[model samples]
Target: MYKRALPPAHYSLKIQSFSLLSKSNVDKYDSGVFEVGGYKWSLSLYPNGDKDNNGSGFVSFYLSIEETDKLPHGWEVDVNYKLFVYDKIRDVYLTIQDADGAVRSFHDLKTQWGFVDA
Candidate 1:
């Protein structure tokens, strides 16, 4: 599981990737494997906006969570992603802020569409 310094224990999301094509969602995938206090957790990503967005542009994403008590599905409850950003001209650094409000690192992709399964 990937470790992230976020509030609460587990940090998860739904859906994963998209296609950046004409009239296509062009998904930006999020690694489904996440952890909280070292405990394994599940997540999924679902398409929220641009239900039919198939153009080239900055892709948007949100965080959704599901507890172990509930069965996994296409769309879960409790979604969370506090820190986020969208590149205007497309840059090399991926925006990611630490829980302490510090810019430590960045990635090549952004978490846009997907849902986390329980």
Candidate 2:
């Protein structure tokens, strides 16, 4: 992980009243659609962690391709992505990505990539 002043180049999601999500029993939240690299995408956030994925006590984040059914059959996309959390005190973003910066392949079977414990 690393810190940087610049925000994510592709897209960003800001939650103003984040604490209320847990109280309201919101297990997961998906951001509105955004386009990147000629494809639509969105951010999926598990505010209280995704228990099913063993992400308890830690935030789980993922980038999901939107409207995958619209794409051609057997379609695939390779992406190198980073997940960021804004550090209010530091005024920088804590960025996390694959340790080796691997290019993850998103296909019909796998439509998202992210950290289980972000």
Candidate 3:
């Protein structure tokens, strides 16, 4: 994974799972857990709310990694990860490509959402 600048803010992101099966194949997925590169990152997916489909299912997700830092201010970090989805047609994991088809840096993902002095 490589770090790419996004205007001014950036985050560490990479393929955490491949061919993930959630069981519930609703038209959309709203909530679920994501395992990224061996680490479990909580995800909040809002594919459709009650207003749309009686409050159920989702198509996409907004990923947020739990993290904490101590270097003061927003410090840059090293990120190496790959993100992918299961390709049912090929029976294999298909790599999700970004606009440039490269690992994206959404923010400093090296830190955890824990006490800094702990």
Decreasing TM-score order of the candidates: 2, 3, 1
Give candidate 1 regions above 4 Å deviation: 1-30, 39-60, 70-81, 86-118
Q: CA lDDT of each candidate?
A: 0.35, 0.84, 0.39
Q: Give per-residue CA lDDT, model 3, range 63-117, as digits (tens).
A: 4454424333675433333335455567897543344544334446543221111
Over 1-118, each residue of candidate 1 has an lDDT whose tens digit, in order, gives 3354555543433222233332355343344646554333433222233344442233444342224334333432232334333333474435543344432221113223231211
Shift of residue 116 alpha carbon in model 1, Å: 16
Query: Which candidate, 1 or 2, would have the higher TM-score against the true structure?
Result: 2
lDDT of 2 at 43: 92
Better of 1 and 3 by TM-score: 3
Q: Note the clash tally of each candidate.
A: 32, 0, 20
For candidate 3, the 10 contiguous residues with the lowest summed lDDT are: 109-118
